[model samples]
Target: MGVFTYENEVASVIPLTKFFKAFIIDADNLYPKIVPNQPQTEIVEGDGGPGTIKKITFNHGGQVKIIMHRLDIVDEASLTYKYTVLEGDLISDTIDQIVKEIKVTAGPDGGSILKNTSIYHIKGDNQLDKEKLKTDEEKGLTLFKIAAGYLLTNPDEYN
Candidate 1:
Protein backbone atom coordinates (compact mmCIF):
# COMPACT_ATOMS: atom_id res chain seq x y z
CA MET A 1 0.00 0.00 0.00
CA GLY A 2 1.03 3.57 -0.60
CA VAL A 3 0.34 6.56 1.60
CA PHE A 4 -0.06 10.17 0.58
CA THR A 5 -0.53 13.04 3.00
CA TYR A 6 -1.11 16.79 2.98
CA GLU A 7 -1.72 19.56 5.48
CA ASN A 8 -3.84 22.71 5.29
CA GLU A 9 -4.31 25.61 7.65
CA VAL A 10 -7.33 27.92 7.85
CA ALA A 11 -7.67 30.93 10.11
CA SER A 12 -11.07 32.04 11.34
CA VAL A 13 -12.45 35.01 13.20
CA ILE A 14 -14.44 32.77 15.48
CA PRO A 15 -12.98 31.88 18.85
CA LEU A 16 -11.22 28.58 19.29
CA THR A 17 -13.63 27.09 21.81
CA LYS A 18 -16.68 28.12 19.85
CA PHE A 19 -15.20 26.85 16.60
CA PHE A 20 -14.38 23.50 18.17
CA LYS A 21 -17.81 23.14 19.70
CA ALA A 22 -19.61 24.07 16.52
CA PHE A 23 -17.50 22.06 14.12
CA ILE A 24 -16.63 19.03 16.24
CA ILE A 25 -19.33 18.63 18.84
CA ASP A 26 -22.29 19.96 16.93
CA ALA A 27 -21.50 19.30 13.29
CA ASP A 28 -24.17 16.66 12.82
CA ASN A 29 -26.84 19.12 13.83
CA LEU A 30 -25.18 22.28 12.55
CA TYR A 31 -23.95 21.41 9.04
CA PRO A 32 -27.33 21.25 7.30
CA LYS A 33 -28.49 24.31 9.18
CA ILE A 34 -25.52 26.35 7.99
CA VAL A 35 -24.90 24.83 4.57
CA PRO A 36 -28.32 24.39 3.13
CA ASN A 37 -27.02 24.40 -0.43
CA GLN A 38 -24.59 21.58 0.12
CA PRO A 39 -25.23 17.87 0.60
CA GLN A 40 -27.73 16.58 3.16
CA THR A 41 -26.20 14.70 6.08
CA GLU A 42 -27.47 12.02 8.44
CA ILE A 43 -25.99 10.00 11.20
CA VAL A 44 -26.73 6.52 9.96
CA GLU A 45 -25.08 4.86 12.96
CA GLY A 46 -23.76 5.72 16.44
CA ASP A 47 -24.19 9.06 18.20
CA GLY A 48 -21.78 11.47 16.61
CA GLY A 49 -18.68 10.49 18.55
CA PRO A 50 -15.75 8.16 18.22
CA GLY A 51 -16.91 5.15 16.16
CA THR A 52 -19.94 7.03 14.93
CA ILE A 53 -20.74 6.79 11.25
CA LYS A 54 -22.32 9.49 9.16
CA LYS A 55 -23.76 9.33 5.69
CA ILE A 56 -23.90 12.35 3.43
CA THR A 57 -26.06 12.25 0.34
CA PHE A 58 -25.71 14.71 -2.47
CA ASN A 59 -28.69 15.81 -4.47
CA HIS A 60 -27.53 15.96 -8.04
CA GLY A 61 -30.73 16.74 -9.95
CA GLY A 62 -32.52 13.98 -8.03
CA GLN A 63 -29.74 11.47 -8.63
CA VAL A 64 -28.49 10.82 -5.12
CA LYS A 65 -24.96 9.75 -4.27
CA ILE A 66 -23.57 8.99 -0.84
CA ILE A 67 -20.41 9.07 1.25
CA MET A 68 -19.74 7.42 4.59
CA HIS A 69 -17.42 8.69 7.31
CA ARG A 70 -16.50 7.11 10.60
CA LEU A 71 -15.39 9.26 13.50
CA ASP A 72 -12.19 7.96 15.02
CA ILE A 73 -11.29 10.57 17.62
CA VAL A 74 -12.83 13.47 19.51
CA ASP A 75 -10.76 15.32 22.07
CA GLU A 76 -12.40 18.31 23.61
CA ALA A 77 -9.54 19.51 25.74
CA SER A 78 -7.16 19.63 22.80
CA LEU A 79 -9.81 20.75 20.30
CA THR A 80 -9.13 17.93 17.90
CA TYR A 81 -11.21 15.58 15.78
CA LYS A 82 -10.32 12.74 13.45
CA TYR A 83 -12.39 10.74 11.03
CA THR A 84 -11.97 8.33 8.16
CA VAL A 85 -13.82 8.08 4.89
CA LEU A 86 -14.75 4.44 4.79
CA GLU A 87 -16.82 4.63 1.64
CA GLY A 88 -17.38 7.39 -0.83
CA ASP A 89 -17.75 8.09 -4.54
CA LEU A 90 -14.71 10.31 -4.24
CA ILE A 91 -12.55 7.32 -3.39
CA SER A 92 -10.69 6.07 -6.44
CA ASP A 93 -10.46 2.44 -7.51
CA THR A 94 -7.00 2.06 -5.99
CA ILE A 95 -7.67 4.11 -2.86
CA ASP A 96 -8.36 2.13 0.28
CA GLN A 97 -9.41 4.90 2.63
CA ILE A 98 -8.87 8.53 3.60
CA VAL A 99 -8.12 9.67 7.14
CA LYS A 100 -8.61 13.28 8.13
CA GLU A 101 -7.48 15.04 11.30
CA ILE A 102 -8.47 18.53 12.36
CA LYS A 103 -7.09 20.61 15.20
CA VAL A 104 -8.40 23.98 16.31
CA THR A 105 -6.19 26.34 18.29
CA ALA A 106 -6.31 29.90 19.47
CA GLY A 107 -5.21 32.45 16.91
CA PRO A 108 -3.23 35.63 17.55
CA ASP A 109 -6.35 37.78 17.53
CA GLY A 110 -8.52 35.69 19.86
CA GLY A 111 -9.95 33.83 16.88
CA SER A 112 -9.01 30.33 15.84
CA ILE A 113 -6.55 28.54 13.59
CA LEU A 114 -7.56 25.27 12.00
CA LYS A 115 -4.98 22.68 11.06
CA ASN A 116 -6.13 19.89 8.78
CA THR A 117 -4.24 16.81 7.73
CA SER A 118 -5.38 14.24 5.23
CA ILE A 119 -3.81 10.87 4.65
CA TYR A 120 -4.72 8.78 1.65
CA HIS A 121 -4.01 5.09 1.72
CA ILE A 122 -3.79 3.54 -1.68
CA LYS A 123 -3.55 -0.05 -2.74
CA GLY A 124 -0.67 -1.47 -4.77
CA ASP A 125 1.23 1.02 -6.92
CA ASN A 126 -1.56 3.43 -7.69
CA GLN A 127 -0.72 7.14 -7.54
CA LEU A 128 -3.05 9.73 -6.08
CA ASP A 129 -4.30 12.67 -8.09
CA LYS A 130 -2.61 15.67 -6.52
CA GLU A 131 -4.90 18.17 -8.18
CA LYS A 132 -7.98 16.41 -6.89
CA LEU A 133 -6.48 16.31 -3.41
CA LYS A 134 -5.79 20.02 -3.54
CA THR A 135 -9.34 20.69 -4.65
CA ASP A 136 -10.69 18.63 -1.79
CA GLU A 137 -8.54 20.54 0.67
CA GLU A 138 -9.82 23.83 -0.70
CA LYS A 139 -13.41 22.67 -0.44
CA GLY A 140 -12.89 21.61 3.16
CA LEU A 141 -11.35 24.97 4.02
CA THR A 142 -14.32 26.74 2.49
CA LEU A 143 -16.73 24.68 4.52
CA PHE A 144 -14.80 25.36 7.70
CA LYS A 145 -14.87 29.07 7.03
CA ILE A 146 -18.60 28.96 6.43
CA ALA A 147 -19.13 27.15 9.68
CA ALA A 148 -16.98 29.65 11.48
CA GLY A 149 -19.03 32.49 10.06
CA TYR A 150 -22.21 30.85 11.20
CA LEU A 151 -20.88 30.35 14.69
CA LEU A 152 -19.60 33.89 14.86
CA THR A 153 -22.95 35.31 13.85
CA ASN A 154 -24.98 33.08 16.14
CA PRO A 155 -22.87 32.75 19.24
CA ASP A 156 -25.49 30.86 21.23
CA GLU A 157 -26.36 28.37 18.52
CA TYR A 158 -23.76 25.77 19.30
CA ASN A 159 -23.34 26.40 23.01
Candidate 2:
Protein backbone atom coordinates (compact mmCIF):
# COMPACT_ATOMS: atom_id res chain seq x y z
CA MET A 1 0.00 0.00 0.00
CA GLY A 2 1.03 3.57 -0.63
CA VAL A 3 0.29 6.55 1.61
CA PHE A 4 -0.17 10.25 1.00
CA THR A 5 -0.53 13.01 3.54
CA TYR A 6 -2.14 16.39 3.19
CA GLU A 7 -2.02 19.18 5.74
CA ASN A 8 -4.15 22.28 5.98
CA GLU A 9 -4.52 25.12 8.47
CA VAL A 10 -7.43 27.47 8.90
CA ALA A 11 -7.68 30.51 11.18
CA SER A 12 -10.98 31.38 12.81
CA VAL A 13 -12.03 34.41 14.78
CA ILE A 14 -13.87 32.21 17.24
CA PRO A 15 -12.16 31.36 20.50
CA LEU A 16 -10.33 28.08 20.90
CA THR A 17 -12.71 26.58 23.43
CA LYS A 18 -15.80 27.50 21.50
CA PHE A 19 -14.39 26.39 18.20
CA PHE A 20 -13.15 23.15 19.66
CA LYS A 21 -16.43 22.49 21.37
CA ALA A 22 -18.48 23.12 18.29
CA PHE A 23 -16.21 21.55 15.74
CA ILE A 24 -14.75 18.58 17.59
CA ILE A 25 -16.62 17.83 20.80
CA ASP A 26 -20.14 18.31 19.51
CA ALA A 27 -19.66 17.64 15.83
CA ASP A 28 -22.12 14.77 15.62
CA ASN A 29 -24.78 16.99 17.14
CA LEU A 30 -23.76 20.26 15.57
CA TYR A 31 -23.18 19.25 11.96
CA PRO A 32 -26.76 18.24 11.19
CA LYS A 33 -28.03 21.44 12.72
CA ILE A 34 -25.79 23.81 10.80
CA VAL A 35 -25.42 22.13 7.44
CA PRO A 36 -28.04 22.19 4.74
CA ASN A 37 -29.64 18.87 3.83
CA GLN A 38 -28.48 17.70 7.22
CA PRO A 39 -26.50 14.49 7.46
CA GLN A 40 -27.63 11.83 9.89
CA THR A 41 -25.04 10.48 12.35
CA GLU A 42 -25.29 7.69 14.87
CA ILE A 43 -22.92 5.95 17.22
CA VAL A 44 -22.61 2.36 16.14
CA GLU A 45 -20.16 1.04 18.74
CA GLY A 46 -18.30 1.92 21.90
CA ASP A 47 -18.72 5.14 23.84
CA GLY A 48 -18.31 8.56 22.32
CA GLY A 49 -14.58 8.43 23.02
CA PRO A 50 -11.74 6.57 21.37
CA GLY A 51 -12.61 3.33 19.57
CA THR A 52 -16.14 4.48 18.94
CA ILE A 53 -17.61 3.92 15.53
CA LYS A 54 -19.91 6.43 13.88
CA LYS A 55 -22.07 6.02 10.83
CA ILE A 56 -22.96 9.07 8.80
CA THR A 57 -25.57 9.05 6.06
CA PHE A 58 -25.88 11.97 3.76
CA ASN A 59 -27.07 12.87 0.29
CA HIS A 60 -24.34 13.60 -2.16
CA GLY A 61 -25.49 14.90 -5.53
CA GLY A 62 -28.64 12.95 -6.30
CA GLN A 63 -27.49 9.84 -4.53
CA VAL A 64 -27.46 8.74 -0.95
CA LYS A 65 -24.08 7.84 0.48
CA ILE A 66 -22.96 6.46 3.81
CA ILE A 67 -19.63 6.70 5.56
CA MET A 68 -18.31 4.93 8.65
CA HIS A 69 -15.66 6.39 10.87
CA ARG A 70 -13.73 4.90 13.76
CA LEU A 71 -12.61 7.37 16.35
CA ASP A 72 -8.96 6.96 17.21
CA ILE A 73 -8.67 9.81 19.68
CA VAL A 74 -10.82 12.48 21.22
CA ASP A 75 -8.92 14.65 23.68
CA GLU A 76 -10.84 17.54 25.16
CA ALA A 77 -8.17 19.17 27.29
CA SER A 78 -5.68 19.37 24.45
CA LEU A 79 -8.38 20.01 21.79
CA THR A 80 -7.33 17.18 19.50
CA TYR A 81 -9.51 14.78 17.52
CA LYS A 82 -8.59 11.89 15.25
CA TYR A 83 -10.61 9.44 13.20
CA THR A 84 -10.20 6.98 10.37
CA VAL A 85 -12.63 6.26 7.59
CA LEU A 86 -13.38 2.60 7.92
CA GLU A 87 -15.81 2.03 5.08
CA GLY A 88 -18.57 3.34 2.87
CA ASP A 89 -18.93 4.94 -0.55
CA LEU A 90 -16.14 7.35 0.19
CA ILE A 91 -13.65 4.55 -0.08
CA SER A 92 -12.99 3.43 -3.64
CA ASP A 93 -11.19 0.39 -4.98
CA THR A 94 -7.95 2.34 -5.07
CA ILE A 95 -8.22 3.61 -1.50
CA ASP A 96 -8.03 1.53 1.61
CA GLN A 97 -8.51 4.13 4.32
CA ILE A 98 -8.21 7.75 5.23
CA VAL A 99 -7.06 8.92 8.65
CA LYS A 100 -7.72 12.45 9.75
CA GLU A 101 -6.23 14.39 12.66
CA ILE A 102 -7.48 17.74 13.80
CA LYS A 103 -6.07 20.09 16.44
CA VAL A 104 -7.42 23.41 17.58
CA THR A 105 -5.23 25.92 19.40
CA ALA A 106 -5.48 29.50 20.54
CA GLY A 107 -4.36 31.78 17.76
CA PRO A 108 -3.09 35.33 17.86
CA ASP A 109 -5.78 38.04 18.11
CA GLY A 110 -7.84 35.94 20.49
CA GLY A 111 -9.03 33.54 17.83
CA SER A 112 -8.34 29.90 17.09
CA ILE A 113 -6.32 28.01 14.53
CA LEU A 114 -7.44 24.64 13.26
CA LYS A 115 -4.81 22.34 11.82
CA ASN A 116 -5.91 19.27 9.89
CA THR A 117 -3.87 16.40 8.52
CA SER A 118 -5.28 13.78 6.20
CA ILE A 119 -3.37 10.58 5.59
CA TYR A 120 -4.66 8.51 2.71
CA HIS A 121 -3.76 4.87 2.37
CA ILE A 122 -3.96 3.69 -1.20
CA LYS A 123 -4.42 0.17 -2.40
CA GLY A 124 -1.40 -1.24 -4.18
CA ASP A 125 0.29 1.44 -6.28
CA ASN A 126 -2.89 3.39 -7.13
CA GLN A 127 -2.82 7.16 -7.12
CA LEU A 128 -5.42 9.63 -5.95
CA ASP A 129 -6.82 12.55 -7.85
CA LYS A 130 -5.19 15.75 -6.66
CA GLU A 131 -8.03 17.99 -7.73
CA LYS A 132 -10.58 15.91 -5.89
CA LEU A 133 -8.47 16.06 -2.77
CA LYS A 134 -8.18 19.81 -3.07
CA THR A 135 -11.91 20.12 -3.46
CA ASP A 136 -12.42 17.96 -0.39
CA GLU A 137 -10.06 20.18 1.57
CA GLU A 138 -12.04 23.25 0.56
CA LYS A 139 -15.22 21.51 1.65
CA GLY A 140 -13.66 20.86 5.04
CA LEU A 141 -12.81 24.52 5.41
CA THR A 142 -16.35 25.43 4.42
CA LEU A 143 -17.59 23.23 7.22
CA PHE A 144 -15.50 25.26 9.66
CA LYS A 145 -17.02 28.47 8.35
CA ILE A 146 -20.48 26.99 8.63
CA ALA A 147 -19.86 26.10 12.25
CA ALA A 148 -18.44 29.52 12.98
CA GLY A 149 -21.44 31.18 11.42
CA TYR A 150 -23.78 29.02 13.42
CA LEU A 151 -21.96 29.86 16.64
CA LEU A 152 -21.97 33.53 15.77
CA THR A 153 -25.72 33.49 15.31
CA ASN A 154 -26.34 31.49 18.45
CA PRO A 155 -24.13 33.02 21.09
CA ASP A 156 -25.27 30.66 23.81
CA GLU A 157 -24.29 27.55 21.88
CA TYR A 158 -21.01 25.75 22.64
CA ASN A 159 -20.14 28.40 25.19
Candidate 3:
Protein backbone atom coordinates (compact mmCIF):
# COMPACT_ATOMS: atom_id res chain seq x y z
CA MET A 1 0.00 0.00 0.00
CA GLY A 2 1.06 3.54 -0.67
CA VAL A 3 0.16 6.68 1.25
CA PHE A 4 0.50 10.20 -0.09
CA THR A 5 -0.13 13.42 1.74
CA TYR A 6 -0.43 17.03 0.59
CA GLU A 7 -0.64 20.18 2.67
CA ASN A 8 -1.44 23.75 1.69
CA GLU A 9 -1.96 27.07 3.42
CA VAL A 10 -4.06 29.95 2.15
CA ALA A 11 -4.12 33.42 3.64
CA SER A 12 -7.27 35.48 3.24
CA VAL A 13 -8.26 39.01 4.10
CA ILE A 14 -11.47 37.81 5.75
CA PRO A 15 -11.65 37.47 9.51
CA LEU A 16 -10.94 34.05 10.93
CA THR A 17 -14.26 33.72 12.67
CA LYS A 18 -16.23 34.81 9.64
CA PHE A 19 -14.26 32.59 7.34
CA PHE A 20 -14.83 29.57 9.55
CA LYS A 21 -18.49 30.29 10.00
CA ALA A 22 -19.09 30.58 6.27
CA PHE A 23 -16.67 28.07 4.81
CA ILE A 24 -16.62 25.44 7.51
CA ILE A 25 -19.87 25.65 9.42
CA ASP A 26 -22.27 26.68 6.68
CA ALA A 27 -20.58 25.32 3.57
CA ASP A 28 -23.16 22.67 2.74
CA ASN A 29 -25.94 25.21 2.54
CA LEU A 30 -23.91 28.12 1.21
CA TYR A 31 -21.85 26.51 -1.56
CA PRO A 32 -24.52 25.57 -4.10
CA LYS A 33 -26.48 28.70 -3.33
CA ILE A 34 -23.67 31.11 -4.23
CA VAL A 35 -22.21 29.44 -7.26
CA PRO A 36 -23.76 30.38 -10.58
CA ASN A 37 -24.74 27.64 -13.02
CA GLN A 38 -23.30 25.10 -10.64
CA PRO A 39 -24.30 21.47 -11.04
CA GLN A 40 -27.19 20.12 -8.99
CA THR A 41 -25.81 19.49 -5.51
CA GLU A 42 -27.41 18.38 -2.30
CA ILE A 43 -26.60 17.02 1.11
CA VAL A 44 -28.50 13.76 0.90
CA GLU A 45 -28.14 13.04 4.63
CA GLY A 46 -26.91 14.20 8.05
CA ASP A 47 -27.00 17.34 10.18
CA GLY A 48 -23.60 18.58 9.03
CA GLY A 49 -21.86 17.33 12.18
CA PRO A 50 -19.47 14.64 13.21
CA GLY A 51 -20.35 11.14 12.03
CA THR A 52 -22.72 12.58 9.49
CA ILE A 53 -22.61 10.74 6.20
CA LYS A 54 -23.31 13.36 3.60
CA LYS A 55 -23.54 12.60 -0.10
CA ILE A 56 -22.94 15.37 -2.61
CA THR A 57 -23.83 14.82 -6.24
CA PHE A 58 -22.20 16.35 -9.27
CA ASN A 59 -23.51 16.32 -12.80
CA HIS A 60 -21.45 16.96 -15.89
CA GLY A 61 -22.45 16.37 -19.53
CA GLY A 62 -25.45 14.35 -18.44
CA GLN A 63 -23.29 12.11 -16.32
CA VAL A 64 -24.10 12.22 -12.64
CA LYS A 65 -21.92 10.96 -9.84
CA ILE A 66 -22.23 11.00 -6.08
CA ILE A 67 -19.49 11.43 -3.54
CA MET A 68 -20.05 10.22 -0.04
CA HIS A 69 -18.19 11.88 2.79
CA ARG A 70 -18.31 11.13 6.48
CA LEU A 71 -17.60 13.94 8.85
CA ASP A 72 -15.00 12.72 11.29
CA ILE A 73 -14.52 15.74 13.47
CA VAL A 74 -15.89 19.22 13.90
CA ASP A 75 -14.11 21.26 16.55
CA GLU A 76 -15.78 24.61 16.87
CA ALA A 77 -13.47 25.83 19.63
CA SER A 78 -10.37 25.09 17.54
CA LEU A 79 -11.93 25.93 14.19
CA THR A 80 -11.05 22.61 12.66
CA TYR A 81 -13.07 20.20 10.51
CA LYS A 82 -12.15 16.75 9.24
CA TYR A 83 -13.85 14.41 6.82
CA THR A 84 -13.15 11.34 4.72
CA VAL A 85 -14.40 10.61 1.22
CA LEU A 86 -15.99 7.21 1.50
CA GLU A 87 -17.03 6.81 -2.13
CA GLY A 88 -16.79 8.90 -5.28
CA ASP A 89 -15.81 8.90 -8.93
CA LEU A 90 -12.74 10.77 -7.82
CA ILE A 91 -11.54 7.63 -6.09
CA SER A 92 -9.62 5.49 -8.50
CA ASP A 93 -9.29 1.73 -8.52
CA THR A 94 -5.82 2.09 -7.04
CA ILE A 95 -6.89 4.61 -4.47
CA ASP A 96 -8.53 3.55 -1.24
CA GLN A 97 -9.80 6.74 0.36
CA ILE A 98 -9.06 10.40 0.93
CA VAL A 99 -9.05 12.17 4.28
CA LYS A 100 -9.19 15.94 4.34
CA GLU A 101 -8.69 18.23 7.32
CA ILE A 102 -9.12 21.99 7.36
CA LYS A 103 -8.16 24.45 10.08
CA VAL A 104 -8.65 28.18 10.26
CA THR A 105 -6.47 30.51 12.31
CA ALA A 106 -5.99 34.20 12.78
CA GLY A 107 -3.60 35.81 10.34
CA PRO A 108 -1.05 38.49 11.06
CA ASP A 109 -3.18 41.28 9.59
CA GLY A 110 -6.31 40.17 11.43
CA GLY A 111 -7.48 38.13 8.46
CA SER A 112 -7.45 34.37 8.35
CA ILE A 113 -5.04 31.58 7.51
CA LEU A 114 -6.61 28.44 6.17
CA LYS A 115 -4.62 25.25 6.49
CA ASN A 116 -5.53 22.09 4.57
CA THR A 117 -4.09 18.62 4.70
CA SER A 118 -5.13 15.75 2.48
CA ILE A 119 -4.04 12.17 2.86
CA TYR A 120 -4.56 9.68 0.04
CA HIS A 121 -4.36 5.99 0.72
CA ILE A 122 -3.61 3.76 -2.22
CA LYS A 123 -3.94 0.10 -2.89
CA GLY A 124 -0.92 -2.22 -2.82
CA ASP A 125 1.92 -1.35 -5.21
CA ASN A 126 -0.12 1.38 -6.84
CA GLN A 127 1.41 4.71 -7.75
CA LEU A 128 -1.00 7.60 -8.10
CA ASP A 129 -0.38 10.84 -9.97
CA LYS A 130 0.12 13.76 -7.63
CA GLU A 131 -0.32 16.53 -10.19
CA LYS A 132 -3.93 15.58 -10.90
CA LEU A 133 -4.65 15.53 -7.21
CA LYS A 134 -3.08 18.95 -6.79
CA THR A 135 -5.20 20.33 -9.61
CA ASP A 136 -8.33 18.93 -7.99
CA GLU A 137 -7.35 20.44 -4.68
CA GLU A 138 -6.73 23.78 -6.31
CA LYS A 139 -10.18 23.69 -7.87
CA GLY A 140 -11.70 23.05 -4.46
CA LEU A 141 -9.71 25.93 -3.02
CA THR A 142 -10.95 28.22 -5.77
CA LEU A 143 -14.53 27.24 -5.08
CA PHE A 144 -13.93 27.88 -1.40
CA LYS A 145 -12.47 31.28 -2.15
CA ILE A 146 -15.50 32.08 -4.25
CA ALA A 147 -17.71 31.22 -1.30
CA ALA A 148 -15.56 33.33 0.98
CA GLY A 149 -15.79 36.22 -1.46
CA TYR A 150 -19.56 35.95 -1.44
CA LEU A 151 -19.58 36.02 2.33
CA LEU A 152 -17.32 39.02 2.30
CA THR A 153 -19.65 40.99 0.09
CA ASN A 154 -22.92 39.71 1.53
CA PRO A 155 -22.02 39.58 5.18
CA ASP A 156 -25.53 38.69 6.24
CA GLU A 157 -26.04 35.93 3.67
CA TYR A 158 -24.58 33.02 5.52
CA ASN A 159 -25.05 34.39 8.99
Candidate 4:
Protein backbone atom coordinates (compact mmCIF):
# COMPACT_ATOMS: atom_id res chain seq x y z
CA MET A 1 0.00 0.00 0.00
CA GLY A 2 3.04 2.25 0.05
CA VAL A 3 3.13 4.71 -2.84
CA PHE A 4 6.11 6.40 -4.52
CA THR A 5 6.03 9.50 -6.67
CA TYR A 6 8.67 10.79 -9.06
CA GLU A 7 8.60 14.03 -10.99
CA ASN A 8 10.51 15.10 -14.09
CA GLU A 9 10.13 18.71 -14.97
CA VAL A 10 11.54 21.49 -17.15
CA ALA A 11 10.57 25.07 -17.90
CA SER A 12 9.64 25.33 -21.55
CA VAL A 13 10.09 28.61 -23.32
CA ILE A 14 6.84 27.75 -25.00
CA PRO A 15 3.47 28.03 -23.36
CA LEU A 16 2.24 25.45 -20.85
CA THR A 17 -0.63 24.55 -23.11
CA LYS A 18 1.76 23.81 -25.94
CA PHE A 19 3.98 21.62 -23.77
CA PHE A 20 1.02 19.68 -22.48
CA LYS A 21 -0.47 19.35 -25.93
CA ALA A 22 2.67 18.00 -27.50
CA PHE A 23 4.67 16.03 -24.94
CA ILE A 24 2.11 14.40 -22.64
CA ILE A 25 -0.58 13.81 -25.24
CA ASP A 26 1.76 12.33 -27.82
CA ALA A 27 4.08 10.58 -25.43
CA ASP A 28 4.40 7.19 -27.08
CA ASN A 29 6.30 8.62 -29.99
CA LEU A 30 8.00 11.46 -28.15
CA TYR A 31 9.07 9.40 -25.16
CA PRO A 32 10.86 6.85 -27.29
CA LYS A 33 12.79 9.56 -29.04
CA ILE A 34 13.42 11.30 -25.75
CA VAL A 35 14.47 8.20 -23.86
CA PRO A 36 15.26 5.28 -26.11
CA ASN A 37 16.99 2.85 -23.79
CA GLN A 38 13.96 2.33 -21.58
CA PRO A 39 11.38 1.17 -24.09
CA GLN A 40 10.88 0.52 -27.78
CA THR A 41 7.27 1.86 -27.31
CA GLU A 42 5.81 1.00 -30.68
CA ILE A 43 2.11 0.99 -31.41
CA VAL A 44 1.45 -2.69 -31.73
CA GLU A 45 -2.17 -3.73 -31.22
CA GLY A 46 -3.85 -0.39 -31.73
CA ASP A 47 -3.68 3.05 -33.30
CA GLY A 48 -1.67 6.03 -32.08
CA GLY A 49 -4.57 7.76 -30.38
CA PRO A 50 -6.55 7.02 -27.24
CA GLY A 51 -7.41 3.41 -26.32
CA THR A 52 -4.39 2.28 -28.30
CA ILE A 53 -2.08 -0.37 -26.89
CA LYS A 54 1.67 -0.48 -27.28
CA LYS A 55 4.18 -3.09 -26.25
CA ILE A 56 7.15 -1.70 -24.34
CA THR A 57 10.15 -3.99 -24.25
CA PHE A 58 13.38 -2.98 -22.59
CA ASN A 59 16.30 -4.18 -20.54
CA HIS A 60 16.67 -3.44 -16.84
CA GLY A 61 19.83 -3.70 -14.81
CA GLY A 62 21.53 -5.77 -17.53
CA GLN A 63 20.06 -8.94 -16.09
CA VAL A 64 16.41 -7.98 -16.04
CA LYS A 65 14.08 -7.66 -18.99
CA ILE A 66 10.61 -6.10 -19.12
CA ILE A 67 7.60 -5.94 -21.42
CA MET A 68 4.55 -3.88 -20.72
CA HIS A 69 1.36 -2.64 -22.37
CA ARG A 70 0.07 0.89 -22.19
CA LEU A 71 -3.68 0.69 -21.82
CA ASP A 72 -5.79 3.85 -21.93
CA ILE A 73 -5.26 7.55 -22.45
CA VAL A 74 -7.48 10.38 -21.27
CA ASP A 75 -6.78 13.78 -22.77
CA GLU A 76 -10.07 15.65 -22.41
CA ALA A 77 -8.48 18.64 -20.71
CA SER A 78 -5.45 17.27 -18.97
CA LEU A 79 -3.63 13.98 -19.63
CA THR A 80 -3.92 10.93 -17.40
CA TYR A 81 -2.17 7.84 -18.77
CA LYS A 82 -2.79 4.33 -17.40
CA TYR A 83 -0.62 1.29 -18.04
CA THR A 84 0.20 -2.12 -16.65
CA VAL A 85 3.45 -3.99 -16.69
CA LEU A 86 2.54 -7.19 -18.47
CA GLU A 87 6.08 -8.42 -17.93
CA GLY A 88 8.59 -7.13 -15.42
CA ASP A 89 12.30 -7.03 -14.68
CA LEU A 90 14.64 -8.38 -11.98
CA ILE A 91 14.80 -5.41 -9.69
CA SER A 92 11.68 -6.17 -7.66
CA ASP A 93 9.21 -9.01 -7.80
CA THR A 94 7.31 -6.62 -5.53
CA ILE A 95 6.32 -5.27 -8.89
CA ASP A 96 3.37 -7.60 -9.04
CA GLN A 97 1.71 -4.57 -10.64
CA ILE A 98 3.21 -1.37 -12.04
CA VAL A 99 1.92 1.85 -13.53
CA LYS A 100 3.17 5.37 -14.23
CA GLU A 101 0.81 8.32 -14.28
CA ILE A 102 1.45 11.90 -15.20
CA LYS A 103 -0.78 14.83 -14.33
CA VAL A 104 -0.01 17.95 -16.32
CA THR A 105 -1.41 21.36 -15.58
CA ALA A 106 -0.68 24.96 -16.36
CA GLY A 107 1.71 26.31 -13.79
CA PRO A 108 2.56 29.72 -12.47
CA ASP A 109 4.80 32.09 -14.45
CA GLY A 110 3.69 30.36 -17.66
CA GLY A 111 5.34 27.04 -16.87
CA SER A 112 3.94 23.50 -16.87
CA ILE A 113 3.54 21.17 -13.93
CA LEU A 114 4.59 17.64 -14.72
CA LYS A 115 3.70 15.40 -11.80
CA ASN A 116 4.32 11.67 -11.97
CA THR A 117 3.22 8.90 -9.66
CA SER A 118 4.27 5.30 -10.03
CA ILE A 119 2.39 2.39 -8.48
CA TYR A 120 4.30 -0.86 -8.13
CA HIS A 121 4.01 -4.05 -6.09
CA ILE A 122 6.79 -5.59 -4.08
CA LYS A 123 6.86 -8.90 -2.24
CA GLY A 124 8.91 -11.01 0.20
CA ASP A 125 10.94 -10.05 3.23
CA ASN A 126 13.07 -7.64 1.20
CA GLN A 127 11.73 -4.41 -0.27
CA LEU A 128 12.96 -1.71 -2.60
CA ASP A 129 15.28 0.83 -1.05
CA LYS A 130 14.30 4.46 -1.48
CA GLU A 131 17.66 5.58 -2.82
CA LYS A 132 17.66 2.92 -5.53
CA LEU A 133 14.22 3.92 -6.73
CA LYS A 134 15.05 7.61 -6.70
CA THR A 135 18.33 7.14 -8.56
CA ASP A 136 16.82 5.01 -11.26
CA GLU A 137 13.85 7.28 -11.76
CA GLU A 138 15.99 10.41 -11.79
CA LYS A 139 18.19 8.97 -14.51
CA GLY A 140 15.29 8.10 -16.74
CA LEU A 141 13.52 11.40 -16.18
CA THR A 142 16.73 13.32 -16.72
CA LEU A 143 16.77 11.92 -20.23
CA PHE A 144 13.31 13.37 -20.75
CA LYS A 145 14.59 16.75 -19.68
CA ILE A 146 17.51 16.44 -22.06
CA ALA A 147 15.23 15.83 -25.01
CA ALA A 148 12.79 18.47 -23.92
CA GLY A 149 15.64 20.95 -23.62
CA TYR A 150 16.61 20.28 -27.21
CA LEU A 151 13.06 20.62 -28.43
CA LEU A 152 12.45 23.83 -26.55
CA THR A 153 15.62 25.36 -27.91
CA ASN A 154 15.20 24.18 -31.50
CA PRO A 155 11.44 23.92 -31.76
CA ASP A 156 11.22 23.05 -35.45
CA GLU A 157 14.12 20.65 -35.64
CA TYR A 158 12.46 17.79 -33.75
CA ASN A 159 8.91 18.82 -34.36
Q: Tell me the TM-score of model 1.
A: 0.89
- Candidate 2 colliding pairs: none
| Alpha-carbon local distance difference test for all models | 0.84, 0.89, 0.81, 0.60
Evaluated at residue 7, the lDDT of candidate 1 is: 95
Best candidate per lDDT, number?
2
Q: Candidate 2 residues 25-106, lDDT tens each? A: 8888999898778888989999888999999988545333788999999888999999999999768999899999999989
Relative to the unseen true structure, what is the C-alpha lDDT of residue 107 in candidate 2, on a scale of 0 to 100? 94
lDDT of 1 by residue, 108-146 (tens): 889899999999999899988799779867876877988
Regions more than 4 Å wrong, model 4: 1-13, 32-39, 48-51, 58-66, 124-126, 157-159
Between prediction 1 and prediction 2, the one with superior lDDT is 2
Candidate 2, poorest ten consecutive residues by summed lDDT: 58-67
Ranked by TM-score, top first: 2, 1, 3, 4
When 2 and 4 are scored with lDDT, the better candidate is 2
lDDT of 3: 0.81
List candidate 2 stretches off by more than 4 Å: 60-64
Query: Cα RMSD (Å) between model 1 and the true structure?
Result: 2.3
**CA-only RMSD, every prediction:** 2.3, 1.4, 2.3, 3.7
Model 3 agreement with the true structure over 117-157: per-residue lDDT tens digits:
99999988998788977987887788768876887788776
Q: What is the lDDT, from 0 to 100, of the residue 158 in candidate 3? A: 44
Q: What's model 1's overall lDDT?
A: 0.84
